[model samples]
Target: MDAGGEEAKQERHLVLAHKLFLLSHPDLDDLAKVALRSDALDAVKSDGMAPLFESLAAAGVLEPDDALLAEMRARIDEEVRKLDEKIADAEENLGESEVREAHLAKSLYFMRVGEKEKALEQLKVTEGKTVAVGQKMDLVFYTLQIGLFYMDFDLISKSIDKAKNLFEEGGDWERKNRLKVYEGLYFMATRNFKKAASLFLDSISTFTTYELFPYDTFVFYTVITSIITLDRVSLKQKVVDAPEILAVIGKVPHLSEFLNSLYNCQYKSFFVAFSGMTEQIKLDRYLQPHFRYYMREVRTVVYSQFLESYKSVTMEAMAAAFGVTVDFIDQELSRFIAAGKLHCKIDKVAGVLETNRPDARNAFYQATIKQGDFLLNRIQKLSRVIDL
Candidate 1:
């Protein structure tokens, strides 16, 4: 065999071994291209070439000797499509959670595709215990495909909830980042810039901290789209100035579209800042002070912000966000209303206080309540002054 044909044979050999990438990974294409090269294939031993061979086979670029490997991939892909169709049918016929069959089939496919470890952690162990082997979220191997479909269809809200449930049920950071990207997507869709920023920051922090690959760029795409969507100059400026945020944007081809709307060329100061303070300034600035503060303080700060924001918040948004039966939120809200800590009478609900002072007892709770109870736990403590 000539050199090129020999290299192609080697690639096919690797593919037959089930060690190749089954699909193109947009995130690691640069690193991945090296593995796809004939030179790279020639450098590796037979065992070491497995992943590369798998990629070549999946790409259909390998030699044709590995009919068995091609057959296996075809079978796996067929089962994946069947499971996807089953999921769609289950959703149409039955109600929620009826698609466990599809999850199981996809789970097996994922396992066969060399994503078994990723599948194992994502498999719903508790649910799997109740159901037999062939169906469960944990058993679903085609999650990544489903996830991408959800993203493509712009069903961000439903997608986020489903992915999050999967994550909380013990899906690893790989799945979590998928949900995080969706969360950012939700904010982007709703035009809620700040929430998008927070979601993106959280995604970057978690993905970087975990050292996971391929997904880091995905979440950043969500953030970039969000920034461009934002009408506010501050939002655009903040993200563009941030280098961790900028690198992903720089990598993507969509930068030119934003230039007319965002004049990013003028920001030389941000560019200088990017080179200088990047290590200290993370993708976001919000989390640093808290990590410096006591852990308990973070929850308190969040709750305080929530309560402050709650005063002017309408029952509608609160109900949707907390995902409660509406009556529950409304009922509890009445209690907060009665206590005077929350004033619901304002004509506006889009904005509210960011914090509350705990020192002044009379600012709220003018209404009399029975003393010696937890009625005003959030109410400011009273100060006593006696002339001696």
Candidate 2:
């Protein structure tokens, strides 16, 4: 790899290190220690990110070293001095573009050093000197990365809006596609799976946002968000049959089985895949927060799909289908039924589940009756107001 590629890889590993620290998995503890001690530490020292180093040290993710901290601070001061000189020289003897570049360099330096506030401030200064919409959008992308690194949703939200506004002033297709992935990530983190799924699907074929994550990670996010939000037909069309997903779905462990088994109506296989991948789900920084919710949604999807094919089914048969005990199936169905997630009623005495899915025509008719009653009440209140 070239110098740039090596630097990018190191930076990516640093981000991964941050994510690893956020995870609570015992299996990843040693891996986290290695990353912090090696690649992550090297990048932090090279960028003179004393703040990040100190934070990691305080969190006990890294060992505290006073001498190394002092050295990093000295390096940061020297680099800032040189950057300030470059800015002054450009302002005194060079053109507007040179001054802008100098300011941008300083901003990028602050970003590398993990100084979020300083980087944002310097970026605003650089943005003041920037003229092209595309260049301005690039600056927003930088801000978005900082937001993502820190998991600051407020900053991420503002940066996304800023990017969209810059696009309205005219932006390229590549940046636009990149922004979709960024926005998709934001929505996913915020638990808006429907919007996240839409944005992810839109960017599946056009994804080039490696700065956010690798292509495989992107595919994983796309599949995860799609399964819960999309109908069966849409899931089959967009994810199961799509060439982009098919090419890389197997790369992620148990993901292909989880997706395919659910779609194929293989209850036992789907259950196994789901159980096998819970660790993967729990390990993800973004998905970890919604892990339990996701588990419930997956069960809901599978149970609803299974019930759709039968008017009534024995609890023993259902338990056998899922490769679970009958008591477990009964309890699962009872909870889902009580919560209104499943459109079925369990008959414990008869040891059978009866599907009572609401009739679409009857539902619409009842909705119309409710609306008519509301309209009549509104007219009567209006008449009383007029009389008064």
Best by lDDT: 2
TM-score of every model versus the real structure: 0.32, 0.90
Summarize candidate 2's per-residue lDDT along 19-63 as a digit string, tens digits.
Answer: 545443565667665654676667677777899889888987667
- Candidates in order: C-alpha RMSD to true structure: 19.3, 3.5
Stretches of candidate 1 off by over 4 Å are 1-60, 66-110, 114-126, 130-142, 145-160, 164-178, 182-223, 243-388
lDDT of 2 at 297: 90
The superposed Cα distance between candidate 1 and the true structure at residue 323, in angstroms, equals 51
lDDT of 2: 0.87
Candidate 1 local lDDT, 190-297, one digit each (tens): 545467666776665454311112343444444444443444465555454555555555443334233322333323332343233232222222222222222232
Error of 2 at 348 (Å): 1.2
